[model samples]
Target: MNILSLGRSLASFIVVYGGIDLVAVHAFAPLRSLSADGLPRRRLTSRFSAGVDLKQNEDLQKYFQAAEERSLAQFARDDAPAWLQTIASLPFECTACGKCCKTIGSVYLSSEETWQAAELMNISSTEFIEAYASDIIRDSAEASNTWVRLKEKEVLKGTDHSPACIFLNSDTNQCQIYEARPTQCRTYPFWPNLLASPDAWDAEVRRMDHDSESTLLEWTPDAGGCEGMMILDQNSTTLGVPMKDVYRQLREYRQQDRYFPTGDKKADTER
Candidate 1:
């Protein structure tokens, strides 16, 4: 079927799956605090997984939290010319494997992204937020606020239960709002976790492989991570340059508390 047909079908499926309801969205408003060293520690609550011993999962959760903290630190240092050089030198390409979308935890939505996605889905922003989004409490020394992000759905795959972004269509393994996807979704593979250091990038490739077997076996960690996918030369590149620009914009957005441009000429010109 065509793209429009697929979108309509997916929309119908979403509604049937109760995506139109406002009460179903899971809120992750756990009280979070940052340590003296600037690492975030989230309080365990029933919202994550009910009827389970959080004590048993504490260590695992801490490890994942530390990884996020490390990535944030890397993002702080992204402006370094040497780091930019390293990023430019690395070889990379997206095969549209959809592995990242499947593996990532949450797709944080800025206010602009939320509105745009709602429009694309042909729904009011309030309805969209009620059905598909939730508020995440972020506490830090510099900023303490709540941000909206897409909710995850629990899907049973064989004997395992996997968490995926609500917009991910399980049958086709494609995003429903690809054209109007959030900046976080648009700026994948160039994330701080994958660009922090050579070792970090290598680790991410391994992690991706472990998460999704569809990732090519040839894209090994030792070969500089996603070997064939990387841009070998700076000349004649598209994604690489745009990704760098995105990286810069993300930094600016964080520092200035401003929304990224939505590429709407009329809207942007009006602003």
Candidate 2:
């Protein structure tokens, strides 16, 4: 039975790798409830699922993308919907499948995040901007804080690839300014918090879900620490636990003050 019909929240179950104690990281609110006749019914819009309000405007894209990543990571858990309850009970763990980070698309950086990245390199923001940040219209439909950094740049000479990010230390394959990295980068592999609609979600799911003989299975991790693997682990299953409330809590959690890569008190956090 579709858990949505039974008034259950759809959650993504996740298993972290490298021998960490399993803790339930992300979950959603129940979407349906059981009926008296032993069947499930969809919760009404007024009280059922929180309607997803997708933002397509370019100005909001990065912020939206960050949110989408967090949300999708939350949903990618093995405990998320579609997986049976039995699978949910199993102690799942990520295998460090770095497929999520390699060959990744653009990772947007906010003004504050950009500045912090510069500091990590012990360079001024001006220098960093000259080296990396470029004003580009990522989306014409909206006025986003659009900036692009190259990762995996095709060498002008022999076939060598490098990332656009100055903070990426080649030997370590890690972000030098991870504490201050952009929210989008922090929340890789799961981007639905930025792209809201289920339809958009369906597209991403189709893009990432590995099938036999799929080229995606051959992918590699972009960096060390396997942080994004956490995201991939989140997306790996469909346990369909209720996650709306969980997301709200996470959003609230982001409000607390913390040191970022660029500097302190760099972001408003409310956004």
Candidate 3:
């Protein structure tokens, strides 16, 4: 390859590897550094749900890719957890409850999302940025980086109290941006399940009901079909939706939680 091409490749390798190293170092640091497991964790805010913070676990790809690659065959072999089985069997359809969309979170836009949203609204990306970007100052950085959140429930001088989602159309209780909706939304129900940590699973189950543990454990493998869900692994990502990409999106929110606490005033801001 040309010198320029080789140099670019090396730069990319450095950025990715360096970032991975940083993530690995911090993965267990908080738990170890403070010597307090009671440290407050980031909770879900707005209309968005939180998932695994893969940035904290540089090895996350191995597990997620495993789920994507192996079929239902390997689930039992790997000693996969029961939550995946329970979710696979449960009828967890969205039901278009609109419960989720009504209270939206600060929506982070992907590069593609930014472009598409601009196109859909027939507005310049700059205009979109001005209207929806959330200001975040990274502690590691001197200057603030621009990020976007979904518009609040109320905009347009109080005339539009509708959910500010460009994709949310309450009239139909549907996401106009459904197909293009962030990967985060598509992985619901299975998310906290796919995350598969015992602590994380227990906490989420407690939200749905206090008595879910026994049932969740029983449904994991032999009886229910959720074992099939565990079939997702790296190879699966290659064929369908990339699991790493989804985890990356969730990781951003996870990492941001360090700075933004749950139930903070900003979360309660009137739409």
Question: Which candidate number would show the highest lDDT if scored against the true structure?
Answer: 1
lDDT of 3: 0.39
Which portions of model 3 miss their true places by more than 4 Å?
A: 1-68, 71-82, 85-90, 120-123, 134-146, 155-166, 193-271
lDDT of each: 0.48, 0.36, 0.39
RMSD to true structure for each model, in Å: 20.9, 17.8, 14.6
- Candidate 1 Cα RMSD after full superposition onto the native fold (Å): 20.9
Could you give candidate 1's per-residue lDDT for residues 1-271 as a string of tens digits?
4557545543443354345321221111111222332222232232233322325645434544565445544654655334555443344556555555555355666554577688889999889889998653243432423346678776667845456678878788789998677645664555544555655544544324445655434432123233325323345233444433434434433432333222211111110
Better of 2 and 3 by TM-score: 3
All candidates in order of lDDT, best leading? 1, 3, 2
Q: How well does candidate 2 score on lDDT at residue 147?
A: 43
Using alpha carbons, what is the TM-score of model 1?
A: 0.48
Writing each residue's lDDT as its tens digit, candidate 2 over 1-271 gives 3435222222211111122211312111111221221111222222222432113223332433455556545544532333322222211233334333343345445455566577677999778777775443243343443344434434456644533344455565566666565654443322333224333333333223445554332232332222222122334434332243333322322421122233223223211
Candidate 2: segments with Cα more than 4 A from true spot: 1-101, 136-166, 193-216, 220-271
Best-fitting candidate, scored by TM-score: 1
